[model samples]
Target chain A: MSTFAEYAISAMLIIGGVFTLIGAIGLARLPDFYTRLHGPTKATTVGVGAIVISSVIYFSTLGRGIGIEEILITAFLFMTAPISANFLAKAAMHLEVRTSEKTRGQTWDQ
Target chain B: MMLTALYITIAMVTLAALLNVYRLIKGPDAPDRILALDTLYINAIALIILLGITLKTRMYLESALLIAVMGFVGTVAMAKYLKRGSVIE
Candidate 1:
């Protein structure tokens, strides 16, 4: 691989790794379920997307033709993550999970 | 340089997975645990893809894909069961 390609892949990997770590930290430390939801849905999805795109570039440059699998997974992930998050939040609401006092939304009755 | 970056990324992703596990174990609510498991699967997918890249093989891709499909289904099922009393009703 060319130096430019190597550099690009490295940068993508690093960005992906950093965002993933940040999202995990947010997930672990956030005060409530709703607030924690923000982390994995937004940050981790993008993080995985970036990393997969790098993989696509790497494999394509390796002369085996473009690997469409990575792209497909990224798309699939983007589609499913929000749906799962929505339902999980709904479940939390149904169960009357506690929310932090600083949270602005009023709790819903089951 | 590339090798070093890959090693660093792997370490960071592993750490992320560990944190997710911590959340999974320490959840104060069921949905919290479910969310942690969802995030953990996603992190596992990332780790598999990274390993594939590092080892320069495509075999890991299929496993990653399978995990993605199963993880989504599992999350949805568990979420439904949590929201309602049963997964199918």
Candidate 2:
């Protein structure tokens, strides 16, 4: 019989795979730097989080107790990714890199 | 059954990694490339953990943790550099 942990791991992997795929698609399809930044930051955060949760489930089911380390990493990732993205976006603006017409129409600062 | 699951996860991760590489190469600008690199590192950490599970080794988890830590540092440094034209500033 498949254990709950196995099922959980399967679900996590599937979800993570979907998120990764979406992030990749966004990266490929987004028009510009700022738009591309939005893709991985949001999608991959959830994707990686799901994978880490799956790891925790699988390890705990193996009687390894709760693996809090993955949790810590997840927290760190969630907190840091946005700040990095914001910093990058600000840097791009500071550098006066050109933006797409779509972005310019959406925001006046461009 | 477990082996099959492991293989599938690995394959998915490998595909994601390849996609990230494509983004890195095709990026028209430096910031876009940096964003791709950030994604790559996060995916890499997850891959390391998955590999650890497949290999039944705790060592890989430790390395994965290190990768996560270092990846954050690398991204932050890169972003700072892109912003100020210098990592130290």
Candidate 3:
């Protein structure tokens, strides 16, 4: 007796959960701050977007008129996460932690 | 079915929170810790939204919005401080 909304919500949650798990694993396993930025910035963005989409679906099904608030939050998060990560990475580079030896000669610091 | 989804979401968020904690503990620099904390707050906000759904309450969504705003402000302030030793600079 489950509705389409219910199925959609379940699928969204499951996908979001998987993305979150991958982000967490990357956060734990990445070797440095620069590398670690890859995890939360990328995976968490998609993960949170999925969750917010699920919320929108649920609320719309409940007749709440499409849950525009969740969409706004998701958009804001997507814009902010990468900016913050970039700021942190730039700050880290300014602080001059040694880059990985593998990247010694890349010379992209600007 | 909803309960099962709720449980799975909770577990995933908890694991995400733990991973952020691990980064905080092992971070070699202050900025690294700040970044980890920022990620933690985002995950926490998502968790709050999920909890609101599970509990069938709209109140938790307000808290999630607050957390989203405050977390972004906090991260920006911390990043500014990391760059210039003063959040305002």
Candidate 4:
């Protein structure tokens, strides 16, 4: 409700929104599937996490007790993102998704 | 000031979601599209939360939670199907 709280919320939202946009841009522009995977997991996770934290701050200061629901969502997201990313990477491997030649890595089972 | 910032955030997030849609449609691979789908849902959750803050209501929270759960399950299932050619084996 105070000006400082408003500013804090605004700052968090801006940071979160910008990172999210960058992640989506990476998704659209990256040449390799594996490279594309890095965008959402890294940037979007932080982005959404900040946004959720801001939500917690906003609601908690709104004269209510601390909010735990948003925290739960944030925790859930952090947990599942890596698992999903791992699965997607595995699927890409099984399907033999193309990789850019510039990619350098130890030999994978082909 | 806060309202203006909220509006800007909503615009930015919507643009991001649109970009995700472009990747979803233009995917050069199945996993690329799936990744786009996954990001889309995550963005949707962010949007819902932002909207809740803007509207000062808690009604959307449950839907956001449900989306998170369902979206993760869907991603895992689709990934498994892609990896093994069937979801259940």
Candidate 5:
């Protein structure tokens, strides 16, 4: 409600938006599937985390406090996103999804 | 103002979602599609929370939490299936 709070929320929203757009752009343009995996897991998660934290700030100051919901979602997302990303990468490796030529650590043919 | 920032963020995130959809459609591998799906749900959650902020209410929080939980499960299940060819096994 206060001008300072409004400004803080605005700044966070812009930051979140920029990071999200960057992540999506990476996902669309990355050369290989494995490379593409970097976008969503890291950038997008950070972006969403920022947005959710902003929401927490906005609602917490608005009323008695509605931050519990936001905190719950944020904690859950931060915890699970990386776990899922790791699984996705393992799955991709298991399927032998092609990687970019420059990538290192790829298993050689047996 | 908060409203203006909200509008700009919504536009940016919407464009991001469009990009995700493009990747989803054009992805060369199954994992690419799965990643796109994962990012799309995250974007959807952002939009929902933004909507709640704009409406000056706390109601959409529940739906956002639900989506977060369900989306993770779905991604993990799909990834597991891709890895083992079966989700439950």
Candidate 6:
């Protein structure tokens, strides 16, 4: 209910929104699947993390004892994003999916 | 104001979801499609959380958590299937 919390949430929302949009842009426009992978796992993860943190702050400021369940979503997302990215990357490599000509390290090691 | 920020975030997340759909449709590779799908679900979670924030409630987070869990599982399964042509051995 304080002004500080309001401003903080606003800033976080802006930052998260921008990062999420950037990640989506990268995913859509990147030339290679591998390059595109960098966007969502890193930037989008951080973006959603910020958004969720802001939500936590909002609820906690409302005298709700810090709604901790949303944090679980962030944690679970952070934990699994890399695993999914790893799986996707490995599968892409195994399948020899086409990469941009500029993309290096074409060797499938493993 | 909180209302403005919330609306902005909602718009941005919705746009991100649309982009994910674009990638899902346009991706030339299976892994690329899988990646788009993964991002789409994540965007969905973000949207749901934003909705909860707007409505001043926490109930939506449960669905967000569920989406997170299921999306991860689905991504892993699809990637595995693409890798070995079988989801479970």
What are the per-model DockQ values? 0.88, 0.61, 0.70, 0.87, 0.89, 0.91
Model 3 CAPRI rating: medium
What is the fraction of true interface contacts found in candidate 5?
0.88
Candidate 5 residue spans exceeding 4 A from truth: A108-110
On a 0 to 100 scale, what is the lDDT of residue B70 in model 5? 98
Q: Which candidate do you rate higher for lDDT, 3 or 5? A: 5
Question: How good is model 4 by TM-score?
Answer: 0.97
TM-score of chain A of 6: 0.95
Reference-based lDDT, residue A67, model 1? 78
**How does candidate 5 fare on TM-score?**
0.96
Better of 3 and 6 by DockQ: 6
What would the DockQ be for model 6?
0.91
Candidate 3 lDDT tens digits, B1-68: 75688689879988988988998998878877987898899898789878877876666777777788
Model 4 clashing residue pairs (backbone): none
- lDDT of model 4 at residue B87? 91
* Model 3 lDDT at residue A41: 94
Off by over 4 Å in 2: A104-110
Model 2 C-alpha lDDT per residue in residues B1-89, reported as the tens digit of each score: 55666677778777888888998998777877888898899889878878877775556777777877888888889878877678884
* lDDT tens digits by residue: candidate 6, B1-89: 98999999999999999999999998798999999999999999999999999999888888899999999999999999999999999
Badly placed stretches (over 4 Å) of model 1 are: none
Per-residue lDDT of candidate 6, residues A5-101 (tens digit)? 9999999998999999999999999888899999999999999999998999999999888877887899899999999999999999999888889
Task: Output the number of the DockQ-best candidate.
Answer: 6
Relative to the real complex, the DockQ score for model 5 comes to 0.89
**Candidate 4 CAPRI assessment class:** high
Find the 10 residues in a row with the least total lDDT in model 5 chain A: A101-110
Q: On residues A3-84, what C-alpha lDDT tens digit does candidate 3 reach at each position?
A: 7778889889888878887887888887767777889898987998898888877777777677767877888888899888
- Pairs that collide in candidate 6 are none
